[model samples]
Target: MSTLPTLICLHGGFHGPGYWGPLVSLLADKGFRSITPHLLFGGTDKPIQSLEPVIEQVAKLVAEETSKGKDVVMINHSFGSFAGCSAIKGFTSKDPSKLSDQNSGKALGIITISGFFPEHEVSLAAMAAASRTARGAPDPATAPQLPFKPTEEGLLEYDGDPVHSFYNDLPLQEAQKWAAELENMSQFVFATGGGVYAGWMDVPVWYLLCEADNMMELPQQQSYVKKARDSGGDVTTREIDAGHSPMLSRPVEVAKFVQEAVASFSR
Candidate 1:
């Protein structure tokens, strides 16, 4: 019997591993092992102001797991995908000398759920700019900024209501419950952008598109899918009939897709 790859899940901005509970529980029921790390840049008690450290943290985890001879399958959501991809770069670099002992791992596949997958040399900021241009909105540089507030310690908090944006498909009470738990994410992560790791070029990738996602519109998600394919990624896609937070609104479907992705890794 083939052992299933260990699932290393990375949650979206303003979220922690806690956000993956529903999906993880389902995977566990099916006899799969999973680990969801709390990213330093997101819901941690101490805030991380940059992306590099977050990537390094994830890389270390991947290395630790793979060093035990465990194959890994990384799953990422929203902005978490950036850090996940970076970790893959850190691990599978062609130049072995450049990789740290704690940053080496073997990844069997990558699964992105409503996540951003930037093309080479294209940052998330650049993608946002392109999205605005496509929508005929004013240039992002000149557009009015969101109503985010910076703390006394200089951390930016996401003050926008997520109900309409992320939890539109959830029941009213359930949406309110999760919204109350949302944390502030680093604004720096959004302002900075860069190309994804070249490691993704050779990995099998599955993109789970949320068709009704108001947070990342369907058109924008499709653009990322195209970029992934153009960059030589062996891309497979599945569309979910839910909003942005599918793990919450449609856990069973997400779990089934995850199972399928794992099964494809061996074939």
Candidate 2:
């Protein structure tokens, strides 16, 4: 609300904004405004994870912050990248709103911690294709033997654990804490409609890739990053030598990378 750069952090599946707790404190220590709104999918006991509800929650938070005169720079993790894109497009765009211009000149840029960027119109067809063509498949932590059948108990296993798959790189305590607060994750957030979907903001884009990410192989993460660049989005990419969850495994280094990204945006 101080007309300063407000960094919005979005966590991925089976995780909440609490995952951003350390980084938020780090950012704030440096005179930045960092926010982590709870995503709806992380804390529920239900087996299904829908993206729409959480998307709405995030959009509302961003809009509220913006209305209070804060410029938002969204930093999304894994699946969170896709969710944030959808939420912003819906909340802050003008007519024919295919893109978000959140804080190009007014605030920092949109930084993706490493996730998918989708097409607009929210098409399942496109999302399905991406999944099939996904460079590195995102295997369900516990895929049902029946293929289409997912277990409610299996859902509870992950929801109850406190550390999602990608965050396997973190220390035990940190991982569990993150997983415990997670709620719902809809199957829809993964879809990619064939429509012309653009971010509702013009904030510059930065993708931080974990060179050793097991969940999304480096090639796959690179593929998505390349797509973002090709789409005329201003994107900068950096690779780290850690597993998928660099924030937990390498918090200090992650913070340093973010600091650099923020400075780059200022220029």
Candidate 3:
């Protein structure tokens, strides 16, 4: 493979690839080729649902690119974590030989940011459950979250402003900027769950948990880290003081996490 690593950025629902634009540019400036696929689930005319198809598409892209000598790494945010895992399953299933080379250095190393990890038989942690069971819960009328879906005009959006509270550590202006840009967000991710999760990969994994995150909350992030660590892979954790969109609120921290994760491989 060529000597440089390719970073794939996956956005959650409602928003398209644009959510990863700033992060992609930052990585590009550092000499990394980044790819952000348009998951045509919410806004686009493309039929992008079902974890299987999405995983297949990611496998095809990884195979096509790695075949040409580019190492692949995926950095997933929120529900995009599921997508990254799905892709890994697809890649290994289609070409088991590629995975046989434990030190091939061409495998996917994922970094899930501000995401969740289920416990035991639980497939996912419902946002509603967090609210319903959460002691001292905020007034329901103040911050009500809607189930993800589409409206007229083919554009989609979601309710709940937990992100703001989650990201309270960030400067208000930055949070508002993200919120404005994120209004078109979708709820398709709400239905997409029970991913074809992989056991583990030889490649390194680093999860960036926003300490003040409100959407997934602190407890959920902890659960995810524990799962990854217990999953029998080279997993690591990086806790950030910012919110869900650390790239926007804290790009340098995110960039450094990426740099250090891929520093060992002979891409």
- Whose lDDT is higher: candidate 1's or candidate 3's? 1
Q: What's the residue-level lDDT of 59 in candidate 3?
A: 65
Instruction: For candidate 3, give the lDDT.
Output: 0.62
How high is each candidate's TM-score?
0.87, 0.74, 0.74
| Poorly placed runs, candidate 1 (over 4 Å) | 44-46, 90-105, 119-122, 130-147, 193-198
Full candidate order by lDDT, most accurate first: 1, 2, 3
What TM-score would candidate 3 get against the native? 0.74
lDDT of each: 0.78, 0.63, 0.62
lDDT of 1 at 181: 81
| Clashing residue pairs for model 1 | 123-194
lDDT of 2 by residue, 108-137 (tens): 466777676766665433664566666465
Residues 17-76, model 3: lDDT tens digits: 675766777878888888898654445443444445565666676766666655688778
Clashes of each: 1, 27, 6
Which has the greatest TM-score? 1
- Give the local distance difference test score of model 1: 0.78
Comparing 1 with 2 on TM-score, the higher-scoring candidate is 1
Please report how far candidate 2 places residue 73 from its true position, in Å: 0.5
